[model samples]
Target: MLKFFSEEIDFKLPFPQKTSKWIKTISESEGYNIISLNYIFCTDDYLLEINKQYLDHDYYTDIITFDNSEEEGKIESDIYVSVDRVKENAETFGADFEVEMRRVLIHGLLHLMDYTDTSEELKLQMRAKEDECLLLF
Candidate 1:
């Protein structure tokens, strides 16, 4: 299952049929099955507070993923995304809001799939994967 929630924001994403199809397609392509997922969309202020509290970053970011996957290779967790950051990044990346939002969503799921971008090389790889996934849209 996949769901979306909006907090401190008033926006609606694409319909669940398209969203679910995209998510499931990506998961299957990545060799994983998404048993469940929860996506929370919030403002920058809300996400910043979460970042400071849980990650101790004290900074702003587009998305933060909380993994609730019980086993080493399972899909079950909550994904938090900031609409404020997504809008800003979309402009910066020269893409529309919908496109950028999808990128962030994929990014969070990729993290759950054990993909990381802690380094330049890894970031490049992650970006490649993101681009590849975007082709499905």
Candidate 2:
């Protein structure tokens, strides 16, 4: 199952059913199944508070993923996305909001799939994976 929600924001994901299918396609292509994935959209402040409270970090990020996948080849997690940050990143990257938002959205699922970007090399790999997923999106 896949769901979308908002926290301290008024946002709607366009074509949610299509989004769910796209996510499922990515998961299956990578040899996994979706149990439940929730996308919670929020303002920067709300997400910042969550980051500080849960992660003990004092910096803002576009997305925060909570990995709750308890079984092998399954996905069960909550993905928090900062709308403000997404908009800013879109402008910075010279891409439209929809494109950037999709990138961030899949970025979370990629994390749950064991993709890491803690180093430059890994970041490149992550980006490549993201691009590959974007083509399916």
Candidate 3:
């Protein structure tokens, strides 16, 4: 199941049904099944607090994923996304807000699928995967 929530932000996700279906397709394509996934949208301050409290990193990030999958090929996670950061990123990158939002959404799922952006090469690969997944919408 895919669920959406908000913290310290008054926001409603656009196209919940379509986005959920697209996410399911992305996971199945990666050979994983969705057990449960929660997307929490929040402000930069809220996410920063979560970063400090949970990750011990005092910084603002676009997304922070907490993986809870217990078995291989299954996915369970709590994905926290900073709506403030996404809006800023969209303006910085000259991209549409909805497009950038979807990118960030799938980026979290990609992490659950074992994709990383720790290196330049891997970052490129991850971006490519994100683009591919975006095209499915």
Candidate 4:
């Protein structure tokens, strides 16, 4: 089952229903049932610390996902998202805050599904999948 784990959140996001709907839809579409998901919404400072501690990076980002799955497909892990970054990106992208938040959520899910966005081509494909899943919601 898909679940959320808030660490240090400022405010609750709108469109939580839509987010859940898309996650379930995407999970099933990928031929996997979500055993559980831990979403930790926190400040940029918090996420930046996590990034440094876990990823060895010294920059701030929107989301970071940790995936744990066995060969038989049992999935578990924690996904950390920065609401501070999400708000800024929403403004920069000229999209609604909820929409941008969902985009971040989908980004993490895509990673869990073994999709990468490091290359231009891969990013394009990932964005396409994000768009397709967004439409489904």
Compared with the true structure, the alpha-carbon lDDT of candidate 1 equals 0.91
Candidate 3: give the clashing pairs.
none
Model 3 over residues 75-118: C-alpha lDDT tens digits? Answer: 99999999999999999999999999999999999999999999
Across residues 25-60, which tens digit of lDDT does each residue of candidate 2 receive?
999888889999999999999999999999999999
Ranking by lDDT: 3, 2, 1, 4
lDDT of each: 0.91, 0.94, 0.97, 0.84
lDDT of 1 by residue, 22-86 (tens): 98888988788888899999999999999999999999999999999987656998888999999
**Clashing residue pairs for model 4:** 1-35
Best candidate according to TM-score: 3
- Every model's TM-score: 0.95, 0.98, 0.98, 0.92
TM-score of 3: 0.98
**How many backbone overlaps does candidate 1 show?**
0
What TM-score does candidate 1 reach? 0.95
lDDT, model 3, position 97: 98
Candidate 4's TM-score reads: 0.92
Each prediction's RMSD to truth:
1.0, 0.7, 0.6, 1.4
